[model samples]
Target: MTATPVDTRPLAIDARGLVKRFDKTLAVDGVDIAIPEGAIYGILGPNGAGKTTTLRMLLGIIDPDAGTRSVLGASNPQDVARRIGYLPEERGLYPAMKCDEAIGFMGALRGLPLKVGKERGRELLEAHGLGHAIDKQIRQLSKGMAQTVQLLGTLVHRPKLVVFDEPFSGLDAINQGKLEVLIRGLADEGTTVIFSTHVIAHAERLCEGIAIIAGGKVPFTGPVDEARDRIPAQVRLETRSADGPWRAALPGDTRRVGNYWSFPLPETGVEPLLKALIDGDAGILSLSIERAGLHDAFVAIAGEAAARDMVTRGGGEAA
Candidate 1:
């Protein structure tokens, strides 16, 4: 008998048919995903879109009503608890704890020796440009500084996988950019990073693969470019005259919006259409093609009304 070749690329997080309920409400429904090792993956959706519930399920914080999952190839997350790092959306820290001590404490919970944790914590804080504040109390730091300390704590043990929930919620523009760099750095160093965020721009710029969940269902998943392909490209053109023979060259579904004529880019290409318009003596004022973004993709996958509801983060039991 021939020996089979081994498959070495195992998924860091494998979840299938996950379902959860809170009383009569369906918090998560039939969710499934395979997060590859050494990749940056994102769970993106509006607030209460079942994103938090799904993360909770994956971490074994809350048992799923149905389906199964594995974390770091283990059947239970607790089995590999020390190998995974998690930063919940709700920030937590002892107000009186020193900056370095807070980070060490977080590592201690994951079984890292307190002495090692403290040393590593100091190293991380210094590297992150907070060297002067290492001994400051958590309550003494600014909001952004405190958040950074919490993030450093999450990585003090050097877990194989890390998850951040709404990591950008309160960050300023400069800090947000810094955090993006940090996440990328982690992935470059061979750590599998997974995060949940309502902000689509972060996923667009950082994630290699993403799952877009809404109303407890994932409408789209896979590569970022693939998700964007769901929405057709559009063209916007404006002419000095609204009525002319050139109008006939436009797509049948074309419509006038504001001062411009908008229509879907056709299969034949815009070159032919532009030539026809010029031949008909039309004055082309302005023109350009608009590529779809994540927001547009979300709206296309989930209906406009549902997307609107998502933007509002409807209901009190948020995901």
Candidate 2:
């Protein structure tokens, strides 16, 4: 008998058929997700798409009206809560508390020793260029600085899994870049990082996989590249000859702007078209093929209305 190879990779989060309703509103319907261990995953959608509700259910902060979920293999997330670090969408810290104290308090809530939490808090502050504000009152720091302190607190316990709900909402560009670096570092150290965001650019740049929710329903979920691949690669062509038989080979939807013609790559592939263009003596000055980005994929998979909502609400901020 031949021995079978076993797949050993573990799942950090597994959810199936999740549903939630508030009165007449169906917030989430039949949503399923599987996230692998140590992966950076993103929950992307427009505003009011139940992204927050889904996250809350996963963390056991709220129960799903229907379906099952497991976090770190536990059916009840609270049973393993100590192993998870969560940063809620709403940022909050006691105004009178010192920066280090606040971080320590957050860690202590998750079962870390106050002394150790404070020590780590100080170190984190120093590493992130907030050492000078370590003893300052929360009210004393700027809004951006306070938010950073709270985020550091979320990691003080060094949990195996970290979940951030709309973490970049109030951050400036520089801080946003720093946060991205921090997230990457955590993943490098074998921590599973999950975040919910309206910003498609962040997901495109950071996530290995993503789940796109629309109107409280999941439209698509899988690897970032897979989602992007739903749409064909775009082609940009610049030819010296404006008119020729080669034009017949171009896609019907091809559009011209000045000297450049742009369209989706033909299904028959570029080789046949290139031959036709050359044979017709249509001088090809510049030609390039570019993959469709997450933005385009979102519009294709989630519908134009959802894409419009994303932009009008907040998605345009990072685009």
Candidate 3:
């Protein structure tokens, strides 16, 4: 018997120039995203930004009009489908089916036997605090519970890569936190987790790297820190008086925001400005700063049109 060697490359997904269209509308345009093994990557964009379309093409559910993609080191995504688990943006489950049965069915479809699926389903449900609902029908579960079960089904097969589309949608704050913990744990165990969301906060908190998609294209793809760097740091300071000699020392675009006066931190440094403010006999009530978050980064990376798109859409989805 001959021994076959395993390929130990760190890339879990390599895709470039992936384009897709529907009718006259181009859903995805020249988007390129590369995900490393065991990474928690987020595809972030607003509604109708072609996020779902991109994921579909990457998973091989739909063929791209142009470009190439490889999943799990294979040119054909279907060949590695069993190694990938997916939870779609839309809810999918047999309403009449029992919770355990539903999960087992999903597992079975990925090549696990019925009996093994059922056994694993029961164990997963129990381990995840859903043991009481072992015999509960899908229709009887709460919307959040149903969503969680579907997520579990996506994992029942123990896939190497898990793809979730809007997984945080419709979940309560507590459940959302739980889902984040779960996803983080999965990556710790060596499973690559990729999820798409319009919520910059979710991506900011959970992802190591992100792709900011807008207007059917990805404008930024890199580590979260790099993305945050796209936006300038904001300096927020509070003082005993709003107007004084400090005004002359203040940076050009200062504005009052709630309790603090804020302005874009100069690239030169904050220490010089701090010295100027202090030299002017400015009474510094409290000196603090607000770093640019992913929301700020999203606006900077996505640009004006996408910024309007994000803000008009509430800057985040319900999740």
- Please provide TM-scores, in order, for all candidate models, with all chains considered together: 0.87, 0.93, 0.87
lDDT of each: 0.88, 0.92, 0.88
Q: Per-residue lDDT tens digits of candidate 1, residues 1-319? A: 2464443677999999999999999988999888889888899887878888999899888899999999999989989989999998888789899999999999999999999999999999999899999999999999999999999999999999999988888889999999999999999999999999877789989998898888899877777777887877899998887788888899999989999989988888799999988998788898999878977887888677666765676333284
Count of backbone collisions within predicted model 3: 0
What tens-digit string does per-residue lDDT give for candidate 3 at 1-319? 2354443547999999999878887878999999999999999888778888999899999999999999999988999999999998888799999999999999998998878888999999998899999999999999989998999999999999999998888899999999999999999999999999877889989998899988888889988988887777888898877677878877889898887888888887788988988888778888776678888788777876776675467322321
Number of clashing residue pairs in every model?
A: 1, 0, 0
Candidate 2 yields a Cα-based lDDT of 0.92
Which model is ahead, 2 or 3, in terms of TM-score?
2
Query: Which of the two candidates, 1 or 2, achieves a greater TM-score against the reference?
Result: 2
* Best first by lDDT, ranked: 2, 1, 3
What is residue 13's positional error in candidate 3, in angstroms? 1.2
- The superposed Cα distance between candidate 2 and the true structure at residue 33, in angstroms, equals 1.1
Window of ten residues with lowest summed lDDT in model 1: 310-319
